[model samples]
Target chain A: MKKISKASLSKSFWRWWYGNLTCFTHEHMQTFGYMWSMLPIIQELYPTKEEQAEKLRTYYPFFNTEPQIGCIVVGITAGLEEARANGAEGIDDEMINGIRAGLMGPLAGIGDSLIVGTYIPVLLGIALGLSEGGSVLGPIFYIIVWNITSIWFQKFIYDKGYELGGNAVEMIVGEQAMAFRESIIVLGRIIVGAMAGSWVSINTSVILTYGLDPETGDKIPVFLQEKLDGAFPGVLTMVFVLLCWWLMSKKKVSPVKVMLLMVILAFVGVLIGFFDPGLSY
Target chain B: MSISWLQAGLLGFMSVLAASTPAALGTTVGNYTLNRPLVASLFVGLILGDVPGAITIAIPMQIIYIALVTPGGTVAADLRAVSYIGIPLAYVTCVSQGLDLAGAEAQGIAGALGALVGTVGTVMFYGTAMMNLFWQHYGWARLDKGDFNVLTKVEVFLPIVTHIVISFIPVTILVYYGAGAVENFKSALPMEAWYMKALFTLGSLLPAVGIAILLKSVINKTTDLIYFVGGFALAKSLGLSLLAATAIGGMFAFVNFQIAMASYKGASSGADDEEDI
Candidate 1:
């Protein structure tokens, strides 16, 4: 009987890393990719083509997860395959699939929030700032920062899952996950708020002309933007962003609808001489 | 300058690669950078021989989709098409019209076209998703035949081939003809008219929508309001740049995390003491 060696485990790891995304479909999601990744392990362990085909059949069930952080599932399953190859009792296909089904959802949430919700925005915010001056450093900085973190974290979790096996899932689903999630969510909120203040550009040059000065025979110009800024700098930008947020979150307005409303508002505002693109600071 | 046959073909091929990045190939670059309009625009600009012009068009377009997230394989607007197709079309239009890259008029064109192409991208995204179903069936058929060896083909090559065909055709046709079509449409229409000004106004306001989306995703609780407001006020009141504001925000987040950790530790320890007793 062939044993599942470190070489074969690494092969499976590379397969999952590369093939996880390739077979994405509306139906079955990442099932095909999962099966493909299991090929090396199944081929080495089962020996007979028929046994291998039977084992591969179990991977066809719907399986999807956040691929980057989801490497743990693959690593855990590799351990399971190793056990089954050694004729360990009670290590059946159902146990493997059940573990996969249970862990995918929670891991997906953690991965998505951490990587998508927090990391990308924070990095991109910095990159956008760097590139505002048209420096090539922005993209380069973003690429290096994102990849180094992603690759390092992915490998660490993958190896942990292998060492701890199926039981390691408790670490992801327990109180620790909630704390990490809440902290990232809070950080994301603050960063986005700062982004809104700095990035949501709304400036106006709408000066109200009323009443002539008796001494100078000159029209008195009262700048509305000045009063708004005096009340609060970037007040208009905040108001506009909040209005957009309200329209999207509370009002249940679709994004496309919100987009249309903004366009219409712009048109009307410009037509009425309230907003001039040229005057936007 | 008119886009030559060679440039158009090369760009079309590049578009396929761009569309395929997030899923089919180059997942690292695709998800990390190329999926962004700003980065994709730079590549398109470089390929088309106009880097600065492309970046100028890409910044506003980037803001429009800044908070874009494709949670659970569901996408509201597809940025791949927007990045590769929309930005290029906007750049081509600006050049043909002699509009200054930094001018409001050019920005207006980019935004309007970006929105239009972004919506079209939704269709393309669905099209690829739908096409992916065929290869899945092929995989099942291979499994039935007990052909585990060719599973790699079903997983990798099939999707790649399908995506290339779907992306290449539309991208080439659009860029090759879309440029002249926009130029003609621009010449015929009075872009200096009031309505066009309205469109430009709308373009300037689109970032608000993007920011709102960001806020909606990040704000999960009412108490989270302090951080949000504090961050905004920090930048607004002190005139800090985004990088500085992000640093300050990072400090706040770190403090918040420590507090959360402490409270969690206290609660868990209290529970442990009770159990011991």
Candidate 2:
């Protein structure tokens, strides 16, 4: 019984890193990359060509997960393959593939919330500040910080997954992971809200003139935006965002339709002398 | 001064290369960040010898798509084409029109142009993803033959080549021809036209769509909507920066998380065999 070498582990890790580079479609998502990543392990564990081919075929199922955090699944499978090669009992193809398939959902949920929802927004917030002043560090900071953190964290989870094997799934879906995911989800929601307020620009500049000024005998051009802001700043932006959300989420209207709706609204608003580009807050 | 035909062609070629880099490099050398309009503008600036101006133009566009996150293969917009193909064309149009690089008008023009380019990019994105399906079929055919050695090509090289082929023509033609077309259209068409004014007006509002798409993805719970409205109130009332608001939100989430965790522990007993492991 031969154990997998360090060199083969590195090759597998590299293959896993490029998992979503190609052939990603609605059908069999990440299947080809999963199969590719396991090639080195399959080759090392099974000496015979028939055995290698059979083992490799097991990874061809519809395997999709957040590729960065999903490396844990790949790493755990590597450990299981090593164990099975040493003639371990109770580990079959279904068990291995089942674990892979199972972990995909939870890990994807956590990874998407943490990485996409929280981290990227926070980083972009910082980057936007830096870039507004015409600083080159904006892009540079984003590249360096994002790559280093993601790469280091991914490697840590991959090694941990290998060590834990089947038990990793239990640990992942356990109380601690749930707490962590929920906390981040809360944080992410807050940040996204903050972002929406700051970033989503919508304002109206239409002025209502009813009465004349007593002193100057002039028409008092009452700006509607000032009154709206007096009530709640970014009120129009919030309303627009909610409208778009309702259109997409509740009404099942496509994003294209929503976008077209905005365009038409903008056209009518501008033609009626209500909304202007300079009116954005 | 407007760019020459040769410069436009060269920039077009570079744009395609830059646009495909994120997919081609595949996270090895920080290509994900390079996929951004800010970075794309940097490279375009370097090539065009106008770094500051390009970066200035790209900053606002970058802000519009700052929250973009494409999870589960569902993309809202493709910023790659906007960055590589659109920014360069916008810059060229600015130069041709003698627009001030520092002015709001310049930024608005570039942003509006980017929004238009990004709409087209959604098509290119689906087209590329759809084309890759053919390659997946090719891999399945090879896999069925029991030849596992070709899997490397299926993962890396084939996809890179497929992306380059799919992205090159549109990027080249759009950047090269689109720049001149914009200039021609601008000279003939009056900016005071109601439709033209409306188009710029619409561009200013397009960022709302980007933000809304993000909100749709992240807002799952009913109670979670409070944090969103709360954050908005905080920003509007206090004039808070995003970082400051996020920090305050983080503190609230920590307390909320502790309570939730405690309840979760109380609800489930230790002897329960729910984990199936």
Candidate 3:
């Protein structure tokens, strides 16, 4: 009974960790990186050069996902490769490829929403606050905190995938995991809203009319921003964010096009005295 | 505020390591870490000898790209260009224009510059990915001959060449020369210029698009927007800090999780009881 050495497993993990998207191409995506990662495992199991090459070719199929969380898929395949080398029943190229294909889509959704959409923004929101007045504490906090947690989480899932093998899919997609994911998404949405309120600043320069100062006989102009804020704080900003969301989600506008549209809006608003930054040399 | 060639070269190297598709230092350390505007601000600050100034400039850019998620490798904006090329140029512009880094005007300029550079970075992202096809094809040919060593070469080393061509040179040129061009432009057009007003106005409005892109990602149903509006009210109306809002949001999430799990248990137990009968 041949087994993959501990040295080879560690090498495989690190290889995948660093090389997942290194040689990425539009055609093959993560195919080369996946193959490179499996090299150590195939080499250890097959022994002969030609046999190793043949085994390595199994991962040559296209593979791409959120690379950090996609570490688990590599770990599962490593376990499958070990099992196939030991002549396990019903474990073939088709079965392994099937598992890989099946996991990529769901995992991408989870990774994108949880890690990218929610977690990073929350961390950045706090960091942006800390960065008040250009403090180094913010970036330093994010870099240290993000790297440690991300690497730890990736490594944790990788080990779990290896230990449980095919059963790992149940752990990720099970009812308990679904509850956990939903709650996290809830948290994500709330933080996104707070981020909108805190960061995005959209104001109107349009004034309804000018009020004269009766006591000093001076022209006292009433500011539109103050009036709007008195009615609802940052209502204009919220409206603009909602408008952008509506245009993108409902009207199917690309972000770049929407940005160009904002340019036009700003230009027209400026021309009509509806928007002004009030800058001078 | 002008970038020296050496500093530009360093920034260029960072961009090589930070490219999205073919990040030389890998995704975690490269794309997610160095490519982020907040993190890149620290490095740019260190390199340019202006920590406070750089961080101040990067704040608005960071907010604009706070939720830049690249699902299926399609990106709205590339952070390498935003962080490296855009920040440096914006820094020079702010310094030349004598705008306070903390003011809305500076922040607006930074946002506008970052968005413009981000598009350019997207083109370079595709270029780097396409060029790496040559090395991948070569590796495939060698692997057909049962050469295992070629995998390491193609995966790790050959991509560096692609980065040098696609990411490194362009960033170096842009940052190094863009500083002088910005100064010239600042001299030509005062802040009172019509185009400048439009530019800053555009800057203040652009982050809405970033926030909207983020909303599109997390808001699956119409009801999800209620949670968003709730958070907005918490921050805007109540004047709560982000940490305070997060604490409140976390409590809601916990309650939601408890309800979900309790229902899950109830459904399973009901099924079990029916089976027993």
**After superposition, which runs of candidate 3 have C-alpha atoms over 4 Å from their true positions?**
A212-214, A217-219, B270-277
**Per-residue alpha-carbon lDDT of candidate 1 for residues A1-281, written as tens digits (9 for 90 to 100):** 44677777777777777777666677877777778878888888887888888888778789888788888898888777777878878888799899999999887776666676567777877777666645666666777888788778777777778777776777777665666667767767777777777767787769966768999999888888878989988888888988988887788787768887987888778878888766221
**Candidate 1 docking category?**
medium
Q: Candidate 2: deviation at residue A107, Å?
A: 3.0
lDDT of 2 by residue, B169-273 (tens): 667667777776767656665566667667677766777776666676667755667878888887777889988998898898899888986787677858563
Error of 1 at B21 (Å): 7.5
TM-score of 1: 0.89
The Cα local distance difference test for each model comes to 0.74, 0.74, 0.86
lDDT by residue for model 2 (A99-166), tens: 98788988777666677657876887787677765667777787778878888887888777877888
Candidate structures ordered by TM-score, highest first: 3, 2, 1
* lDDT by residue for model 3 (A150-250), tens: 99998888877777778787877788888888998888888888888888888887777888888988887788999999998898998999999999888
Best by DockQ: 3
lDDT of 3 at A281: 52
Question: Whose lDDT is greatest here?
Answer: 3
Flag regions of model 1 displaced more than 4 Å. A1-3, A87-92, A203-216, A220-224, A251-257, A260-281, B20-22, B184-186, B270-277
Per-candidate TM equals: 0.89, 0.92, 0.95
Q: Rank candidates by DockQ, best first.
A: 3, 2, 1
